[model samples]
Target: MAAERGRPRLARDTIVGWMVLVLFVSLLSVVIVVRESLHVSVTERANADVTQEIEEFRTFTRTGVDPETSRPFTTAERLLTVYLSRQRPGSGEVIVGYVGESGVVTTSYGAGAPDVDEYDLTRDPAVLRAAEQGTSGTLDTPAGEMRWARTVVDVRGGDDAMLLVAVFTGEGTAEADRTVRMLTLVSLGTLLLAGVISWLVAGRILRPVRQVQEAAAEITEHDLTRRITVGDDDVSGLAATFNRMLDRLEEAFRAEQRFVDDAGHELRTPITVIRGHLELMDDDPASREVTMRIVTQELDRMSRIVTDLLALAKADRPDFVRLGEEVDLPALTISLEAKVSALADRSWRLAHVAEGTARLDTQRVTQAVLQLAHNAVQHTADGDAITLSSDVVVDPDLGPALTISVADTGPGVPVAEREHIFERFAHGEPPDGRRHSGAGLGLSIVRAIAEGHGGRVDVGGTPGEGAVFTLVLPTHTPASHDHPEQT
Candidate 1:
């Protein structure tokens, strides 16, 4: 089935791709900016070098005397030759001396000098025009772009001469190219590393979601035990929430199945009894009347069973108990004692009534207490001491609480039955060895009511003495209408 859906794009890949693309663009921008900056700096430095050389030549012409001989230079050729020979140019720099219409007189080259013809300024008319104007500027030549500055020297005894200082830009441009190449290579390597790291980190972050998907796929109506292992991140928190939802769903499904099975089992017995008696009945009026009575009794029993089942089922719903009403505990106890006193002829007496007001569903609490009272009456004879009571108690976990008890001198529940006595259809040993009459749903209803009120009902006391069934309830109202967590 998953194959039919084809392969969906994974979040990890998308995250890595976006990260790499953004990083690539940023690094590319850096490389381009740095390369341009280096180019500008190199061009400025070459122009400065050409200007300085021109200034030095002008200073030499002013002095005129040769530094070696300490005598005035006699001719333009000797003066130009002397200046060219005395100066050492920078890298990619060249100095040329020209006399009169003789064009090129003598030339000097710097380190890493290009081919002699590359910087032959005489061959370029535009350069000659600019030099004639006594201005410094750039022009393209065989050695690439060159920045040049020139000055003319006039000597009293000889032909006039021109001194040109030209600095080629090839070396600086080559260095910038090399730098850009290295930067691009490093940027590519860094991008590759970023992509690899992003893939690993994204996979780790999304692992919990994948596990949740796997767990969901494994779950069904009959199976919901799979769960994702949790962590501290937001993704892990989602997995935790999903696990909690599964827990609720599993409980709901189990309760539904149990209700169906128990309802079928309990209802079948009465149905069979009614059907058998009806089938055997003859035309005799008395026999028909007896059969009809039996059928009616069985139907009533089935109705009670179904009603109890529904009550238990509704206990799981959010609105099972309407809370937020403050009720006087003492007055509630009085009302309960008066009501349960009519259930049987047992001697009903109030042991205690708790003082104070509490927020609770009074109707539900009253029903649970009365259920305990009824159970006590069922196990005892007329005039047996059946005491009803309520009081304030301190629970280790719940803090201040209210306890209501119904104690009766009857056949106490056996030790083995106490654990599951509140379970549906669970019956204790017959009281006084007499067959109990009604369907075994009363105590279960009592338990459901107690739980709905965020309380519990438990039986204690030795066998052959009497059982004390008490409901321990919280004094404060629950925070929500949803069922409280069971202790």
Candidate 2:
């Protein structure tokens, strides 16, 4: 297929070539028209000069007398001499006559023989043709073509004879030929100028395009920050779009880097614990059993950390959550209370429920709330109270919101960690001396789910008082006309 197709043309070169071709053709056309006009003017002048010379010769031959000398010519021979010497034609003109048996070459101009008798009239096709025609016409002669005319006159010596008057146009044609040569040169020069202009203009317009190519070439995995400079034209607009794409790629790269670092760090501790316990195992059944139990527990912790990281990673995907679910807030709140009751002996109660429904990922919302309930249980006493609530609120700037909060009577987060408590690997130290094996991924998971629904998570409480973790999610898409009426 590749061989079957012809080679591609470069845009700049093609355009320039076309421009030059058009210029050459146009100028050549002008040159032809101008050259033809010059030839016509030259021919007209030559024919006129020859015609007037013939008329003058005829008048003297018939009258047989010179207007200046005012005397009758006795014979054809005398008439010929008077016409040649007395009324000779201008430069580049020729005159010849034949009276009875005598022939004479009266005048000659330009190069070649001055005597006309040197060449026989009968053998010369030009002179013979002119004599046969009996009128003025162009003919090929020794001095090139002549615009000649001929007439027969009765000679006093005896019989009638021929007279000729002609002008050589070869010399007259020189000026027209020079004009045509100059025109041809001018046409070629015009074509060159046109090609140069086309090439320069194409380069100027494609400058930004070249910049985009260079910028794209410079981009790499480690350095996605390269950007192309924009200009004022449409090609510059394309460069702007190219820069924006690079920005998005750079952001995605940084995000992936952070994800890898966080995942590696979180999995390190459990892996170390598992390795240490397995290495220190003894041959005795009791020691082996204890090691197995410790290793198994660490494995469970590691599994949970991996699960949380996977969830966070998928949160950025398009189908990460079931966004089409129409969740019933009252029913969701009731189910959450019943579910969290199994976590601990804490008093799990439903504090509030919004009357209406919301559009969101129901399963994800439940998972987030469940994570918060577990966190609260981990920090609170066995008998402490925990309240789960779901209510929708309307704000001028934020629109309608589905706010679900979990409040517990536990060791609340300290004032210092409030801002970053929702960050991955950010957690409050357990109040009790006994340590809890949480991956510090619960709140971050909760925040991810909330933000996935175009919302956020916030905490509210004093340092000593029980803290309330609120998951405030926007239930409605900003431009949603999918559900015209409130659900």
Clashing pairs in 2: none
lDDT scores of the candidates, listed in order:
0.83, 0.75
- Candidate 2 per-residue lDDT, tens place, 110-209, comes to 3532345544444476576556666677776665656777777776555565677667766667778898999899778877887888889877776666
Please, what are the lDDT tens digits per residue for candidate 1 over residues 1-487? 3752222226777888999999999999999999999999889999898889988988888876877788988778889988888899899888989998877888888986576655566677888888887678888877788888888878878889788888889889999999999999999999999999988888888877777777777788889787789998887898899999999999899889988998898999999999899889999999999999999989998998898788788787777777655788989899998999999888889989899987677777877887788888878899999999999898786678888999989889888888777778877774356556766778888887767777778788778889999988888745654344332
Stretches of candidate 2 above 4 Å error? 1-194, 429-436, 479-487
TM-score, cand. 2? 0.64
Global CA lDDT computed for model 2: 0.75
Global fold similarity of model 1 (TM-score): 0.86
